[model samples]
Target chain A: MPAPRPDGACRDEELLAAVILRLIAGLRHVAVGAQSPIPATAALLARHLGKGQPFVSLLSSARHNFFTDGGRELFDCAGQGRVDAFFLSGGQIDGAANINLVAIGDYAAPQVRFPGSFGSAYLYYVVPRVILFRLEHSRRTLVNKVDFISAPGTSPPGVYRPGGPVALVTNRCVFAFDRQRGRFRLESLHPGHTLEEVLDHTGFDFDRPERVPQTPSPSPEHLDLMRGVVAPLLAEVYPQFAATVFGFTRQEQS
Target chain B: MSAIFRSLDEALAGIGDGAMLVVPPEYGGVAMEATRALIRRGLRDLHLVTLPASSLQADLLIGAGAVATIETSAVSLGEFGPAPRFAAAVTSGKIRIKDATCPAIHAALQAAEKGVPFMPLRGLVGSDLVARRPDWRVIDNPFAARDPIVLLPAIRPDVALFHAPMADRNGNVWIGRRRELATMAHAAAKTVVTVERIHDGDLLATEASAAGVLPALYVEAVAAAPRGAWPLPLAGEYPRDEAHCAEYARLAATEEGFRRYLDRYVYARAAA
Candidate 1:
């Protein structure tokens, strides 16, 4: 395996993965869905750091999954509270945490159609620590109000919702969800990013502290674990991401 | 107790136009070969239901103008990218979409399997999916006061179709751990299957094998089509043809390109 960066600087994806690791710490089970390499990396990293305390289930990898009952088992397990953490992304996310994965315009006549909601509606309500991850931080993606609500961030009092958004992780910063207020509070800005930059890109209003801390860089131990231990495992499911981020290819591992 | 093993055409004859057909996800034994045949036969007004989500199969059918309605949680090509045909069709208002969540589809099928009217599921209270789907009712939980839940109507499809690794003369299919196929077969009025090969021995002959077998009781017909799930992986048998899928994604991006794809892959290949 290639060594960690000589400059001790972590790549953007590595930093995102490290952030996910911190968010999902101490969870019993973390399930990474299809098309999420950074979250998958974080789940695997957490497994290594925690000495395999939390079982990692990658939906795309036959090797990483433990379910024998097929695709429905994941949703079934999440329904029963077996899954502790899961990831969700959207074409548009609002201050209230409503995610739009369906379409951009009217339901009857859409301007842009996204992939239909894939278990997000239920998983967001059942999985206690549902982490919202969107790599792009822009006005278009972070909207004031979504065109459609694939899944809402908060529910009414009578709604049997045990799971909801705990935090929204973006490329610029992390915004922790205030479930009570139905709003996002800016938690921290990532390295080389500013509060003004985040505000400029954001379309929705969010609360921020007077003194915001910079999102910490991954420690040397975390970087080594991500590169040496997690990268190879991730290559099994996300070969393209592994190749791009860690410079590790499946052929080399084989 | 023997199954009516027929040619692929004969096996799929019962699935006429305007039929509500239920299918599996991309990973769960997709019948790519059969999908191509359906397009070749030029069946129309198909109310296609995906057991949660789908990818290439759904996209191809939509691009072929075979599907009039699609009931699915999502249709995406994973790493290859968004399903071009599906996106285009939906944006153009070319087909009716019954947007669903993964669990909603599963629970609805399970409800049908048990011959129930509907199944009460947690979540989806605030989602527009419930609002758009008038068939999905949100009722106060009978067991608990002030608790609301969504109840999905049982989806009893006209036919269920998929590819499997193997089937025996008795029509018992060994699905391994993909038990959702069993649920689909149970919920649908008739089930059609295509297998890579027919097993000489009875799938139910051994307890180990019988555990994963979908009995012929639900199956209407079976046909043998080796590598039936081409382009898509069939679990233990083969990995997905990523190169082919990427090529498909590139070619299926436009109407003209999609027609070219049809000419090369679907129309050119003779149905066995």
Candidate 2:
């Protein structure tokens, strides 16, 4: 019998990273903003796989980021079509692709107010591909409609929107957004999650195939690269995340 | 153009009630010491703008009742969790919120820097924030056939306040590669800066330093406040006091606890 994959094996975060890495393929530039550990990991991994073809920019790092002008430069780059892909998360995301990063409940008196929108509204419109990621996949997060639209999923015709939501990745499943149809189509279900559970937990309606497929797990080689290679790169900006996700500790090089 | 001041209090002078103030994010050189000084001054009704987003500074000011209205994209405690005071005040209708997206704030400030009435942006076409924001308008792109774009009014603040790694005798602050500080200074009527220390010579004299210098032309005042960006980071300089931040997150979870936090950290330290 084949031996199990070594001491540092895959976890949910690693799986999510692999999924995001696949989604970001063929992009020239993938930029990750503050506090997004998974996307940052995926971007770094993609760079490693692409042999530095697609440049990765982690907004939190001083060394990795080439933008001399600070956070504003990131917006400028996105507006100029220099950024290819970006990641956005929300307190609540509706089926129509609307994301609520503002508050939940009422606008006047919210029960919960998330960290204000972090350039998602602008990046959603400018970046060619914007991937919506939320680790928690439940009715509360995946809602029928967001309380306050921090960034709408779709825009009116003839608007100068070169970008919008492309796909949403959650713990339970993956959904590809149809910009023309203004709805999501279920692509695949993650392992250990069922269609019924996804339907039960999801608050929004989406199209789906009669026979859904399971999200493929990362191969042993991919897992090795992620833990050994990408994890160290991630430590530059997100040390805590790298430590927590892959048991990666910064090592002193000779 | 000797903008040097002896104290944070003196540097922050001239900023009175109802003045519009702009600041940077936690990592991008936030003036935490200056912010505390402002809080201690018992300032009121200030219009505070976070360049795009804020963390502790906004919440601290809002909690202290120093802010009347805030115009920014978002505020949170980051990894520590949601900002308690900001959430409470917003939910209780204590402060007026001008919810913005990240780039919108940058674009508006850019407009102010260029002395323009407004700047047209590509996004916010169908956002509810667009519908709610009476100030932001959607107009046909003048150059395009039928393309609609969002136009944000200029955000010309009365003062732009921040902390930096160093400043020189000529009042030129070396902000390094964090150029948003320069943008803020250009957009505001006056700019107040607090630095870790004074550089021995003119920052603009050296080519390496000149690239990162916010010239004295835009600076109104400067003060030396070492570790000015404490509890937060100064980009390439120091890491945040993470343990303190975590403790702050733990204590600032409730109104009473936040009050105690103010008494212990902000008020008590100032008195000491």
Candidate 3:
């Protein structure tokens, strides 16, 4: 791949759709949270694809209710990890890639109260592969250490571990475990973002890749499904969230 | 040959102001259409006491002043909009809050249906929640003379309004799943069933999983109302009908908007 983009070529929403479209499939139950873009889009896309295929394929079809009625059952059931893959996010994620959705301060009383760990703890235990998606890129967003470990990473890294966050899919690029150190290692940069830009936003340091790859360009098909289908669906639940997660036009910003 | 309603007003004629009612989720797959109408009526202080938080209907009632208290297990879902409002209402002391597990709530209804004193449940020992709930009695099994166990008294709701995909005049109902809503109907003093379509009258004769709905003796009304479960769904009916539920979620998101909603849609549009 050519030099990695300085600031991620694709919009975050496009990456979100592509990640979900690729990762989530063939599960009977798909659970998400109140303000989830990936799970919400996945459930809708799953249903649009076929309710019978995803949930029924898992043999959990009998218990699953795919994306009908605003995907209530799916959102409610995210922690059980009966879902094929999960989409998760947090206020601050550390160098180790541990998630923090509960709070930003001390345990007893938090300085800032985000929706205290919707199902991060449980989803960490159950879901097979979790795509941790973050929209904002700022020092505050990427922390040296998470204020709270809302969800734990694998007990042992670079090994076949079932529980814990599987990958970190963010606005910039994908980050994976540095098998030896168990710290987040920069694997690829978005098409447009550079290493300097990534470091500027990161709160902690990660070992650099000799050459970061471009996050694959979403196919026109993927973009259509994402912008046309997924974005509208997310907008319904979270009204304020207009424009794409990463595809914010100047119009949306203004 | 006729539509399911005698006119929304006549169908609603019986549900007077401050009518006490009870509803349950079939474990889940709670219906929403008919209940939405009842919700509209209740949006203005109907003295409704929800047995637990099964139906999305709880939020609508809580806003209308129909529901003064909320009783149930820890919310199964991490994020439910009405939950925040209902929780706020309870904590703010605007509504009373009570604790009951999924099993306890079901058992109570089962007891009411079986005409028993109380039903035994699997868990809830030494939980701090035990201290808060008054309706639950921790007493020795006088009959068995055994160690003390928690006894949740049967819930005999004054009226039960339920929606099914289809119901016959005789009151036989069929739904997509085997849920707990049936138990609530069995225990209630009266059951009013609204169905999406009444069918060719032989509809009640079909042997579906939920076929043994409240018998005619127990059912007082059978109005036909489709999309009963708006924000929620009735299994095998139609896919969740998201656009419809989204509209409701939008309307119910705020306290003031939800109340005004109750007034305009629930009260004004109410057939009665």
Candidate 4:
């Protein structure tokens, strides 16, 4: 077991953001939806790293969003192959990358109902790279098969799908999606977690290398940029997350 | 010509039981005061079409038993977590839910706006939403063989209701960059709105504001209701009352607690 880090070191969120930044490195545009602070952080960091090459659009932020035409423009942009990357989370995600954002049990009488599918049903097909992110890495969330397919991982041969899952980032590990095989391959385990821990908690089967590398932590420069620049920018849209993680309060921004 | 109503209730008078009411998303101006007035009026069996998605406004309407069916992509309080009343309603089968994706809702409304019978959307071919929604159809595209797409029917609502930062006496509502409000107004048969204040001059008079104005041509009525989008934020005006939203989420978790909330906020307002 890895020992807990001392104070002032890189947090788990910072590590995850670093991992996500690598996945979306060369993308032209990365758009983030509501309630995804970590992905938002990564997108912002990616923009900073790219020297303003990749435009980051936070749907909830007035400062970050460039859409003058309103919410529909996001979808329009995705359909036109303009949006390069996006993120989606699920109540239950399966091995094949199927995500269930609707209900847990029967469609008529559900045992547990999550928020209905947002843009996942559409953007998952249009956005070139859809990053599946779930902070909780547990059996209940990552199931063998989703109860409902809010958006499918892979479409049939004839389906018009320019986009699908490219990678899934969880707290425990990172898994890269293979479009041909329609499955996930464990890429790396996060710091302080083991392959056994990932296997123990995961509900679905996935391919893994014999010797998995540990996910690299954010560098000093990455930390400096995130903590100093991105944290304040993030405060405008996700005040709670900024306050909790970076101690950048909304009051400070105002 | 758009009629300027004396009160929010009067502005919403044309919307009766079973009316199809289209509303803006949470970030777009939400007509929460009008929603409370609707609850107070005891309107029932409404078919709510929340443009793409919603938060407090949809949940409150569902909790108040004002909505019989909801056609929306999702309804969750952004940070506060899942909408308790909406979750309970879905679990208990109290209201009919027509589950849709965000862009599907937008496309459907855009179809109505363009006077088109149906609109073709790119995704949702393999989604279970395709299976559930019998109204949605998958067909081989005529333009290209072996390519499949989904078509969504136009959603023409009976009334479009929302709150805005301001509206001129001529009834042009200043929505700024929130153009979805204009889309809703254009698609709906009638459009009613509550404004924070009435502008002294024409909203379309200035070239700068004209681009953001929803012309009085589409507006049926406008009423003055200060702080109309309470608990929900209106852009450039007031920020969201996070504490009140958290309180609502906590209180509305249980049936008894939800009733207490209604008595305090919804029903109590009748006297005020």
Give the winner by DockQ: 4
lDDT string for model 4 (A1-254, tens) is 12334554887888899999999988888999988999999999888878887999999888899999988999999999999999999999999999999999998899998989999999999888999999999999999999999999999898889899999999999999999999999999988899999999999999999899999888888987888889989878887788778877666221
Q: Looking at the true structure's interface, with contacts defined as alpha carbon pairs within 8 Å between chains A and B, what fraction does model 3 recover? A: 0.01
Candidates ranked by DockQ:
4, 1, 2, 3
Candidate 4 Cα misplacement greater than 4 A, ranges: A1-8, A252-254, B270-272
DockQ of 3: 0.05
- Fnat, one value per model: 0.83, 0.80, 0.01, 0.84
- Residues B123-196, model 2: lDDT tens digits: 88888788879999988878879988889999999999999999888888999888889999999999999999
Tell me the tens digit of each residue's lDDT in model 3 across A1-254.
Answer: 11223443555666655666555665655555445655566566665666445542111122233333221233234423456566668778888767775456654444553433444544454466666778787799888888766555544422223445556777787777553476777777877788889988989888877888876776766555655554554543433343435242222210
RMSD of each candidate? 2.0, 2.8, 9.6, 2.7
* Runs off by more than 4 Å, candidate 1: A1-4, A251-254, B1-3, B270-272
Model 1 Cα shift for residue B156 (angstroms): 0.6
Candidate 4 achieves a global lDDT of: 0.91
Model 3, position B131, has a per-residue lDDT of 59
lDDT of 1 by residue, A1-254 (tens): 66546776888888888888899988999998878899998999888778877999998787889898878899889989999999999999999999999999999899999989999999999999999999999999999999999999999887878899999999999999999999999999999999999999999999999999999889988888888888888877777678788888776321
- Output the worst ten-in-a-row residue range by lDDT, candidate 2 chain A: A1-10
User: Each prediction's DockQ?
Assistant: 0.68, 0.61, 0.05, 0.74
Residue lDDT tens for model 4, B1-272: 34565577778898999999999888898998889889989999999998989999999999989899999999999888899999999999999999999999999999999999999999999899999999999988999989988999999999999999899888889999998999999999999999999888888887999999999899888999898998788888877887788889999999899999999888887423
iRMS value of model 3? 11.6
Model 3: per-residue Cα lDDT over B32-88, one tens digit each = 555566564444434443434443566556655666545554332222333444544
DockQ of 4: 0.74
Off by over 4 Å in 3: A1-11, A21-37, A40-83, A88-124, A134-162, A175-187, A194-213, A220-254, B1-56, B67-161, B178-192, B202-259, B270-272
lDDT of 1 by residue, B95-120 (tens): 99999999899999999999999999
Alpha carbon lDDT of each predicted model: 0.91, 0.87, 0.56, 0.91
